[model samples]
Target: MKSNRVALAALLGLIALPLVVREPYFQHLMIMVLLWVTIGTGWNLLAGYTGQVSFGAAAFFGVGAYTAGLLSFHLGVSAWWGLALGGVVAVLVGFPFGWIAFPLRGAYFALGSLALGEVMRQLATIWESFTQGMMGVLIMPTFLSKLPYYYIALALAAGSVLVVRLVLGSRLGYYFISIREDQDAAMSIGINTTKYKMISLSLHAFLTGTAGALYMNYMGFIDPHVVFSLHDISIMAILVGIVGGVGTVYGPAVGAFIMVALQEVFRSAGFGALEALSKAIGGGFMAGLTKYVSQAHVLAFGILVVVVIMVLPNGLVGDWRKVSRLFKRAS
Candidate 1:
């Protein structure tokens, strides 16, 4: 009950944030947080709950993005339609891939996912006539204001959380958890492990693809390199799942918020706070620090990942009790 109240309060605060804060930059950050929430939730659903670790989220993301972009470029349809179709297309890709890859387990499955993403990237690059290759794709955005996109992103994030909650509360959720625990046992119990695994993969691909379509519509431009980036998309999704709390319902939400904030802090050189400090201190070492901070975001991410793994292997939310105990010991 206490946790529920806290979550409600946080949601209310976020819903009211735009009314109180008008900075486009801040709004952009929040948008990113929501986007990651969507991606992370989908990743957690498959990898965390179903025990099928995937490193090919970018493939689904890129396919959805390209679906949306191509619709606008070739079909003269609104890119918004891609929001609905993108997930379908991703499921199409995931279905066949899941059929082939689900037979493999553990690290082998992970490697298969990696290969899938690389294949998609190469395909996007080679098919210059169809995909426009490195030239990229662009479309006119529907709204002039950021508010629409913000609300839509919020809806996507919230809806994902709700869906996860509902699904986990259902019978299928138990099957997924069982499979994650031991697929052989699940199969012995007549769970049809393969079917459930495919279902999880399809759901994951759909959610990720939907996010990609949203990205295309909001950002107005995309290239193969940008959309299909393994490190930026696939690895980040894994990080979000691990950092948040792999099997927890709201873990990805908290993880996304933290990760996005960390990203922005580095990307913006502490939101230019370092520059202000440099100016105040006469710009010697602080200025040099500011110059390098933007370039060091990836380094910061790596250090955080190591720290999180060492200190809280189950993740921030999954190991909340342990974390609190540590804090108490320190105090």
Candidate 2:
């Protein structure tokens, strides 16, 4: 346990990077990465560990962002309080989603969550009175400097990691693992699967919602489109989960770093060069992947995701640990 604590502290120190990275653009990217990392970790706790497979994370995320934005714009409330309010609302709403769907297992649960997310998205779009419709509410810029945003994002991401670690180390985590492996078997053994599952969902929603509120404060804008983007819902969180080795404690963080790093690298490599490289390597593979993607970049991301999933089903971190253990055994 002492060794584990030391290792965790060392890993966190490494994450406290970019404090010295002076470029504003890099800082912006770092902040965005951390924001997603935080949200992804929250999502992982429910879907990965608890085996809930939620697609409604975007709903909570959008709710939190809009909640904070609305309060700050109309009522002159501080963001700190707004963040908590958003989290509470998300947890309350999320409870029903889990309660209704918890009886169903596997894909049915996933479909229900996806349906809920879409409903929330549509509500945000139509509810102009509160959400401001397509025009969206803008957060008047206060301190334009990226430093504060960077630190805030970092803190949130760290908080998420710590929360997940705590959960994984506790008795509840063992129950979640049992439930994930076999719900019927776990329930047969006398675990209250329903109560624990709801708890996981509620906590997940709360944390994701809090991160969403932080996002609004950082970006200074909130629109239904930006807040509840389907691409953001289906792709971003899932991709992080897949890349990080879904159920593993350290997987999401590793996945976030790799995903953000790849984006940064591709963006820096010049779009034309990236496209040319993609075409040269896999002709139609990259082209088909990029088409209709809102971001409009080449489909390198999809190909990357596919390769990672196939080559490392347990995810990058999990697979890397296996290799390290194997090497140590051989030595």
Candidate 3:
């Protein structure tokens, strides 16, 4: 009960953030964090809970992005409509793909998902007439201010978390866990493993696709490479799930916040803190250090992942007891 109050307070604080800090750049970062939370939550539903690791989150993301972009480009409809329809389209795509990929197990399923994402990227690039190919799609954004986008993203993230929590409390949730723990055991108990797996995939795809649609509207542009990049979208989703605590309800929320902060720190060279220090120090050494740090964000990310895996294999939330013990020892 005390934890719930603290969580509610934190959420309320986040909801009131834009009113206090009106900076567009910070708001943009918050938006990204919320978006990742949504995607991470969906990915967790399928991979973390159902024991199905997917590398094709980018496929659904790209499909929804294109769905929104295309509607505005061709039909002259509001791209906003895509927010509602995008997830549906993603489900349609995932249904057949899951049917085929469900037969594969473990690493093979992961590979199949990776291949699916690659195929989607290739198709988006090759089909020039329909998708405009690599030229990309551009659209006018509805809102001039970042506040609306931020709030919408926050709501979406909150909704995804709530839906997952409710599902995990139901009978289907147990079935998902059973399959994840031992598919053979789940099947022997009269559970249709394939159907449940497909259901998980569909839910995952829908949430991811909704996020993609949001991205299209927020960013005002879309390209196959940007949306469907394996490392950027797919692997990041996996990292968010793993780093946050895969099977835990609130893990992705915490993971998303940490990963985004880490990404920005390296991407911006410690958010320009290093550059300021370099100027104060007045030396080539400091300048060189800043340059190296800026260029090594990816390396830093890799090291962070490795360190987290080694130190807290189950993630921050999942390993709360270990973390508390470490703090106690330090004190």
Model 1 per-residue lDDT tens digits across residues 1-331: 8777887888899899988889988898898899999999999999999999999999999999999999999998999999899889999999989999999999999999999999999999999999999999989999978889899889988888888888899978999999999999999999999899999999899999999999999999999999999988999898888899899988899899999899888988988898888999984788888989988988888899999989888899999999899999999
Off by over 4 Å in 1: 278-288, 326-331
TM-scores for candidates 1 onward, in order = 0.95, 0.86, 0.96
lDDT of 2 at 286: 66
- Residue 215 in model 1: lDDT: 93
**Candidate 2 residue-wise lDDT at 187:** 94
Q: Quantify all predictions' global Cα lDDT against the true fold.
A: 0.91, 0.80, 0.93
- lDDT, residue 289, candidate 2: 49
Each candidate's number of clashing pairs is: 0, 0, 0
Maximum-TM-score candidate: 3
- Candidates 1 and 2 compared by lDDT, better number: 1
Rank candidates by TM-score, best first: 3, 1, 2
The candidate with the higher lDDT, 2 or 3, is 3
